[model samples]
Target: MTTATPYDAMFSGVIGQDYEMLKLLAPLAVEMSRLVGATVSQHPKTDDKPLSVVELGGGTGITTLSILAATDAIQLLSVDNEPVMQGQAQKKLQAWQAQGKLAFCLDDALSALQQLANGSVDVVASAYTLHNFTNGYRQQVISEIFRVLKPAGQFVNGDRYALDDIDQHTRTTQTEVGRYFRILTAANKLDLLEHWMVHLFSDESENHIMRESLALQQLAAAGFAGIHLSNRSEVNALVTAYKPR
Candidate 1:
């Protein structure tokens, strides 16, 4: 039997089945745009120019829409590797693309970020996406984000985190699973709920969420300054780090 990839097991068909679950990222995206705007305003060179924002793993474009609504004069690029997710976003964001406000790229996040020139972007954002990477690869991706950002640019991500304490991590994981159970149950989609329970609660290598402190440390090691946890719950968090001027 063929082994299931992370994308195949957890992410494939996610947009069609649980798009509402993805909308939870919208508030985080708004905060990311706010930080991006504030950071850009502090730099006179980029203040007047259109903000260049790159979103990694732009699933379904809900977060994209939130960012666009939160900021003005932005040139947004929504990049993802999944065709189905990109297709869903493209349909919703077509009007914005026609108006030169948005563009969708079907590409891997790391390669796309690497191809951009140094200091070419004002902000790099992602939601519930980076956790898909292992701890080591996630650090490399963070470093790449640091590389492409303009001076004083921000990297904002809202995603799940693991705790340092094993017991706490277990507890948090259980709570998160329970929360999802309630959500899926209330939606009256028990069939989908069963799939998600296995996908989320399973100890899969692809679901290796890093400890919040370690993630912050990785950002600092990548030369990001002003690292901050903007929001947090037991398992979910929004973190922001800045490229120093």
Candidate 2:
């Protein structure tokens, strides 16, 4: 009894298949989801109302599912500009949406964060999303994250935090790309491989990749306290910080 949206026509098959391929190929994604989910779940309750969590990206609902699965005490708003991507998420997380535990904002991350009132959110979380933003805009988004967080509210990001050592970063990227080609080719998923290669190129873009040192510096500069790398797997890392009470 569901109405078919335009996204269904465009992304219903290919996008979902691509994400499934990603899950198989990128183990770091699994870790990112786990870390972000556990971090959100562990936040101390502020009141009787469910914890309010804002998720950036929400691509295909992987991280969204993690956040929801980790706890029933959260009311989550997941933001993404891509209709097809969010549509994929909507399909995956329809139950939560139906239960009134989840919502979606069809907008860019920075703009969505800006719309939130000062000191409004309990946690801001993302996975493999912020590193794709242009540096200046990413900084603005970081500042806004600080602006919207209630005192003692948390920001947890499990993302591609490139190694500060350029040599190691390059070597790691090469190895990962090789693995991607091997895996996808073996699976006869060359189309997905191409998609991932393009994404990898974006991740390696000088204007985009947020190195570990810079990420910590930006979080600290944004007035977040106790900023630190909580978990790491090669360039993938879990960065956690909190707003001061």
Candidate 3:
């Protein structure tokens, strides 16, 4: 009889190149996930009803695991368009789904948010996913997040937020790229190095990267109050905002 490989052990191999490149952001992701867990715990359940949470992109259940660990009374809807990534998440998080604490929507963030009823969910959360989108689409998703949230509901995100200073941003990106080249070269992962470098470029591009200052501005404009950067490590930031009651 063969023993099953633990989900945690299998996760890295399942995610492939993404695991190698994105492992750099793991520390920041942990902080972000913990913040989301803490913030949601602050909002008490209403009329014994479970707290409704809509997670924007459930990449292999990393963030989802954190949220579920926070409370058993949460109903989590994890939305992601990528089937492979979502499948991995589903497998890892099967227990939560079986317990009726989790469900998934295989759809893009904006479309999934659009389908949610206005003032329906208690929280909207994401990790390391939003910055990959073009500014226009991201704004649309933010507006939808505002719409779907119940009054006083929260939005928590942990993601790469480019620095507002162009000079500093450029210097930071250069240093990061240099480090990536050194590490990947040592690992003889030049193929992954090239892929990560291009992805990094796309992330830093004008139409894609959301500067830290700009994200706060967008959140405020969307009518979310208590907008603030809760945590930051290099370019990764955890931003929290709320719809006023």
Candidate 4:
């Protein structure tokens, strides 16, 4: 029998039903579609074919459904390692799958991306997922995203970023914790709040999110141009970057 890692164990039942967390993807979907549309418009070859998009860590299909509703895309491949999460997404995206507009792959995001041909994808997007990777592994994932993207292809990601200053990071984390605590308490969901608190304080290296500046720097090093923070609230941010044409 295999034992679950701390990360897997923590997220096993908690991630899929977190409606508050999932709702953030709605606005992120709009922003991501806009960036994709803007980028495809700039490149005529992309306009000639249907846009191919890959979404990493597609939990519960919230982001996928939001994107599908907000954008017109030829193909979308949603990749995730968790079977339960994938099942949720698959159920939600069945109509799109039947229409050849969406598909779900049961695989790790990095492994799935590595299997794709270089410069084949038009866009890659993710929400609240990549932050689970350590800075080093996250950089590797960014590099793979860079490799797989066609020239001028875009990557839009919505996730938490570490603050550059220690004090600010602490304050931001504290504020977020307080906000969640109050909300959960008001909703009489102390059990859920406890689960979140435990995960928040977990000492896993993979839980360490990179600062926005460092993340942008990594994207630049991976040969992405036009990197920018498109949206932000407290520690969460939506960032967009492009592979140079």
Find the candidate with the highest lDDT and give its number: 2
In terms of lDDT, the poorest run of 10 residues in model 1 is 1-10
Q: Sort by TM-score, best first: what order? A: 2, 3, 4, 1
**Number of the top-ranking candidate, with TM-score as the measure:** 2
lDDT ranking, best first: 2, 3, 4, 1
Worst 10 residues of 3 by lDDT: 5-14
Compared with the true structure, all predictions reach lDDT values of: 0.72, 0.87, 0.81, 0.73
Task: Give the alpha carbon lDDT tens digit for every residue of 95-186 in model 2.
Answer: 99999999999989999998999999999999988988889999999999999999999999999999999999999889999899899899
Clashes of each: 0, 0, 0, 0
Comparing candidate 2 with candidate 4, which one achieves the higher TM-score?
Answer: 2
RMSD (Å) of each candidate, 1 decimal: 3.7, 5.0, 6.6, 3.8
Segments of candidate 2 deviating more than 4 angstroms = 1-17
Q: What is the C-alpha lDDT profile of model 4 across 1-245, one tens digit per residue?
A: 12453342345665445644524423443454344345433433456567788989877776777667656656889998888677877877899899998888888888999999999998888877787776777888999999999998888887766667768878978877787777778877776676677666652243455677888899999999988895576666778888998
- What lDDT, from 0 to 1, does candidate 2 have? 0.87
- TM-scores of the models, in the given order? 0.82, 0.92, 0.88, 0.83
Model 4 clash tally?
Answer: 0
Q: Model 3, residue 14: displacement in angstroms?
A: 10
The lowest-lDDT stretch of 10 consecutive residues in candidate 4 is 1-10
